[model samples]
Target: MAGGVAAGLVAGALWGLVFVAPRMVTGFSSVDLTAGRFLSYGAVSVLMLLWAARGPRRVPTGSQALAAIGMSVLGFTGYYLLLVLAIRDAGTEVPTLIIGTIPIWVMLLGKPEHLLWRSLVPGLLLTAAGLGLMMASPHAGTTAAGSPNYWRGIVLVLLALACWTAFAILNAAWMKKHRDVNATEWANWLGVATGLGALVLWLVAGSPARELAAQPQLPLFATLAVATGFGSAWLATILWNVASRRLSASLCGQLIVSETLFALVYSFAWDGQWPTPAQWAACVLFTLGILASIRAHR
Candidate 1:
């Protein structure tokens, strides 16, 4: 369990950096990024799938498989699409802020938090205030319908958060109940499905295979995509599986909020563009709000 907690933290930190990737990788279309990531994940999954198939296979059955699969779609594919959309439409800050609210979203969605009853409103109010404060960036202060792109990105980010929370919860359940049904295999199947979906989308969008293919050596880009999607994600889930075994679901949920802190620090280091003091203050407030929200639930 200790090992699992450590792994989970590593996974969480790795995930925190993902928000930076879409902003970094150049010369790739949005579809390219999605396709590259899933395709690589699918390739790796196939290898693992075949290896496991040749051995003692502990694949999931009816309900477990269904739930795991649902999680993959929501957590993996849906999250990626929304993330891509958010990144494309708005810059990183907006999407990052939306993602910052994920713990709150998950907590609110759970309904029966194990918190001190009176603290719920205070926790929630503080967190929401912090989020609002973050939104008040001097440059980004007004979220008018004026910039469809920015608002669109914001909406997608929120959708992504909701989807990610659902995925995380279900994944925890799956890992808890069906210990034998390997999450990697589950992820493999999901990646395959996502790759296929991307393929179809690619064809529909008139992006020729020739386009991705002609780029002499897109293998690195595609491989990185795969690693981030399948590799890192699989590792993260494994860590999550371990962590959940040790921690309460709610506690684990709270710990997960720390990813935002990781993201903020890393983002600043990765990109020299720091938000104004107001933005930083808002982020700090939101972090406190999240802590308060978790306390209320406890």
Candidate 2:
């Protein structure tokens, strides 16, 4: 249990880096950022697979590889694109708030057969109240520093939330069905798939060429990409798997709140602004709601 708690905290901290990385390269659009970040992720994943395969690890079949790639599209490529766009158009607060609801969403969608309506209702109400507080808070749209489209950002983040919920549930199902594949290996494969997805996005969607033509900060961009790719995406994936292995489903669900906590901390630090009074209250409410939901699920 202590190991699970430690892994959850570390994973949350590492995952928080994603929220701040988009800020560092605001000059690039979300598409460009996704491309660069996932390319790095793909490269590292390849290296990982090569090293692991040397130790008698089984390589994935073509069909299994394709399944992983498709999941990576939903979980990594598309999700990052939407997340960065949300952070760009709104602030971290609203987007993180929406994302913070993912655990509840996963439980609602993934385990509907086992839900207890009595506890579930109260849990949902608390979650709704918590989200309402965040929406009504004065700090809701102020944290982005320069973003201008809060409504658009909110919608994008909700989409990201759905994408992630689907990814989490489906990924778990896949792993359960294929016990031969270890978590680290599966993560690396997803990274490879994300790279492929990013390449397609780069070819068809982004303005990376123009963004670069306009005196992009190459060094800073590279550093941010590596941090997000390796630290947030790769390291967080591994640590999360560790926690998931050790913790019960309900406790693991509650622990996801740490991601929102760390993300909020990093967002405030980046902007050199303290959370407003309402923001602080909202945070408390969100924590309570998450706890309630997890308890209900249990």
Candidate 3:
């Protein structure tokens, strides 16, 4: 359990770093950057899958094959699109606020009633308060710190969370169905599938023309995209899954907050965008609310 929590924290930290990398990759629209990432990841993932599978394996059922395709689209295609857009437009601070939304998402999806309209009142209130802080935070608009597409950034982050949450739900079911496979093997192959789907999605969205026209970010964005699509997406998933197996679901849930914490600290320390007192207060209140909600769930 301790190992799992520790692994989760490590994964979260890496993801936080990757989340900030997209903004550094110049010229690519968020979509373009994402397209570049998927293209690279598809290549890398296939190689890894080949190495893992050792040339030949038994064929999958029609249903299982379909599940892989569906998972690829839902988990990779949807989530990466939203995540790239959010990071590109929002800078880094605004997305920190969105990370606070995950616990509520997990809880609302069939958490025990005792933690809801009954015994868990304090938690419910705290969660609500945290959400209020997030929504009320001055960073929620289209003019965030001089950025042009501020509101779009906010919406993009929320959409990322929605895609990710749905992915998690489906993933749990997928794991149960494929319990016979080693967890690592399942993850590696699914990553291969997801990368392929992302590539198809990218080409269909007109990446080649965009890449030719928007050339300022080719080398830089390609680096970030590879780091993000391959390392963050694949490696992080592998680590998080290992950790999730060891940790309690609730603890696993709370550790996600660590990513926002890491991102904010890095952004503040490096970018010199010192969080205002209001932002600090909001962050503290948000943490308290999450703690309250977690306790309530228990």
Candidate 4:
């Protein structure tokens, strides 16, 4: 359980990078970024598989392959595409706060049979309090509330939230049921599927290669895509799968708050400003919520 908690936290840290990645490459569309990142992830998976060709490898069955593709869409390609669009349209803060509620939903829905509802209250309340502070902070709500784009972004973010929340619960259940399917293998399979889906998405919606090449920040875009693909998408999925296999989904969900906290840290650093006192307090509360959740789970 301790190892699972650690893995979950580490996954959150890596996942946080995605929130800032879109901002880093303003030249690229959301589709381009999504496609590039997953394609890179796919490329890495292929290399890894080739390197392991000399050793024993477990090829997934048809059902498992189908499951991987569906999960890849819900958790990787579709979720991220909508997230980037939300950030582009509504700015980072609002979308992040909405997504931050994922933990609450997961916790409520994925509660363990042995754990009492009361046992979860402390963690849930602390997390809610932290989100409240973040929402009330002056740095939040950057997009004008009245704007059509803002509403559209809100709708997109909500859909993204639904995708990921379903993924968290279903993925955890799938991992628990299929204990023979190791985390690394599952991650690789999912990566391959995501890559395929991302390719289709890119071919359909991504900016032209010529246009992308003409941009001054092409190198920056490439760097961000590869970095996030390897670190955030591939490696983080492995870590998250580890956590999901070992911990209850409710516990794993609570740990997702780490992503939002790390994202805020990265965002503030990017802007060359420190978080306000309210933000700091919110961070503290978020940490406390994780601790409380861990204790309850134990």
Candidate 5:
């Protein structure tokens, strides 16, 4: 269980890089960034799949393939598109706060036996309050003119939250039912699915290549894309699978709060300043919530 918790934390640290990526490449549309990152992710996944195939493993049937595609669409590709759209249109705070609610949803969707209402409710409330407090920080504020479609952005992000909650719960259920399906292989399949979706997105959105060609920061953009694709998407997915298999859905959900914590740390680091007192207090609350959730399992 401790190992699972650590895995979840490490995955969160990797996933936290995603929040910084958009800010790094502000010129690119959310779709463009999503496409490029997944393209790179797909490329790496192909190599991994091929390497893994050399070993003796059970081949997946049609149903498993369909499941992988479903997970990829809802969890990876669709989720990314909506998340990017939300961040672009609504600014980061709203989208992020919406995403922060994923743990609550995950707990609700998880196995009933794992949920201890007594401890779980307080932890979730604390987590929500901490998330709200984080928004009060200067770092969460956006200077851009208000998005005309702010409400649309909220809807999009909420949809993303739904997609991810489904993915997390369903993926965990699938893994639990099929113990033979190794985490690495499953993660690779999802990566392949995301890559294919990226292709479709690129085709429908008028290739991110043209957008890339027009930008002077091509090298920087490419670097960020590859780095995030490999580290944030590919590797993080694998680590998340490991944690998912080892931890209960409810516990795994609470651990996701670590992503917000790491994101705030990254934000403060980017600003070349330490966290404000309120931010630090929010961090404490988030940590306490995680601890409280763990205690529920006992």
Candidate 6:
């Protein structure tokens, strides 16, 4: 359980990088960024699989391969595409706040049969309080609520939230049911599937290769893609899988608050400014929520 908690926290830290990643390469289309990142992940996964083939790694069966593809679409390619589009349309604040409710939804739906509802109240309340603080913070930015694009962005974010929430529950259930399927192997399979899906998305929607090549920040874009692909997508998936297999889905869901916390830290660092008192307090509340959830689980 300790190992699982640590893994989940680390995964959150890595996953947080994605919140700022699209901003870093603002010139690129969402499809390009998504494709580049997952392509790198797929490349790495393929290389690792080849290396492991010399040893005794288990290859996924046909049914498992199909499952990987479906999950990759839900949790990786489709979800991220929608997220990038949401941020592009509506700015970051509203979308982020809406997405922040994911832990609450997951906890409500994924609660263990043995765990009492009262045990979850403290964690849920603390998390909600943290989100409230974040929403009230000036740094969260304001959106034009009346704009068509804003509503569209809100819709996109909600869909993104739904995709990931479903993924969280189903992925946990899948990992728990298939105890023989190790975390690393599952991550690799998903990586390959995501890469394929991202490739198709890119081919269909990304800018032409010549136009992308002409961009001044191409190298920066590539670096961010590779860094996030390896750390955030591939490695984080392994850590998350480990956490899912070891912890209840509700506990794992609570731990996702760490991602929002780390994302704020990264966003502030990138802007070369400190967080406001409200933001700092929110971070504290988020930490308390995770601890409360951990206690409840134990």
- Expressed as tens digits, the lDDT of each residue in 173-262 for candidate 2 is 676677677778878988888888888998898775766667458778878888888888877777776666655444455566668778
lDDT of 4 by residue, 51-168 (tens): 7777996789999999999999999999999999988888887888888899999999999999999999999999999999999998887544656699899899999999999999
Clashing pairs in 1: 114-297, 114-298, 115-296, 115-297, 115-298
Tens digits of per-residue lDDT, candidate 1, 78-164, equal: 687788778778776667767877666655554444554465566566666766776676544232334668777878888888888
By lDDT, the candidates rank as 4, 6, 5, 2, 1, 3
3 against 6, candidate with superior lDDT: 6
lDDT (tens digit, per residue) of candidate 5 on 1-298: 8888888889888877776677776577787888888888888999897887788655668898899889989888888888888767777655676687788889767845745577688788889889888877675645322668787888888999999999989998888888888888888888888899889988888445666798887788789889988988888888888889998998889888888788767756765778778878888999998898888865
- Once superposed on the true structure, which residue ranges of model 3 sit more than 4 Å away at CA? 55-60, 87-91, 110-149, 209-216, 246-251, 277-298
Question: Which has the better TM-score: candidate 2, or candidate 4?
Answer: 4
Q: Quick one: best lDDT, which candidate? A: 4
In terms of lDDT, model 6 sits at: 0.90
lDDT of 6 by residue, 25-51 (tens): 768998998899998888888888898
Once superposed on the true structure, which residue ranges of model 2 sit more than 4 Å away at CA? 112-129, 143-148, 208-216, 245-251, 288-298
TM-score between model 4 and native: 0.98
Question: CA shift at 40, candidate 5, in angstroms?
Answer: 1.5
In angstroms, give how far residue 73 of model 3 lies from its true place.
Answer: 2.4
lDDT of 4 at 86: 88
lDDT of 2: 0.76
Extract clashing residue pairs from model 3. 142-151
The runs of at least 3 residues in candidate 6 whose Cα sits more than 4 Å from the true structure, single-residue gaps closed, are 143-148
Per-residue lDDT value at 99 in model 5: 84
All candidates' TM-scores? 0.78, 0.85, 0.78, 0.98, 0.93, 0.96
Residue pairs clashing in model 4 are none
Local error of candidate 2 at 224, Å? 0.6
Give the Cα RMSD of candidate 2.
Answer: 3.0
- Candidate 4 Cα misplacement greater than 4 A, ranges: 143-148
Look at candidate 5 and give me any clashing residue pairs: none
- What does candidate 3's lDDT look like per residue over 1-298, in tens digits? 5566677777777667656666565655655666666666667767776775676664557877677677766667677778777766776666766755665565456344344445445554565565566557665432355677777878888888887766655665566456665556655666767767766666677457755556875677667778877776777777777655554444455556656656666666666567666667766765665466445544
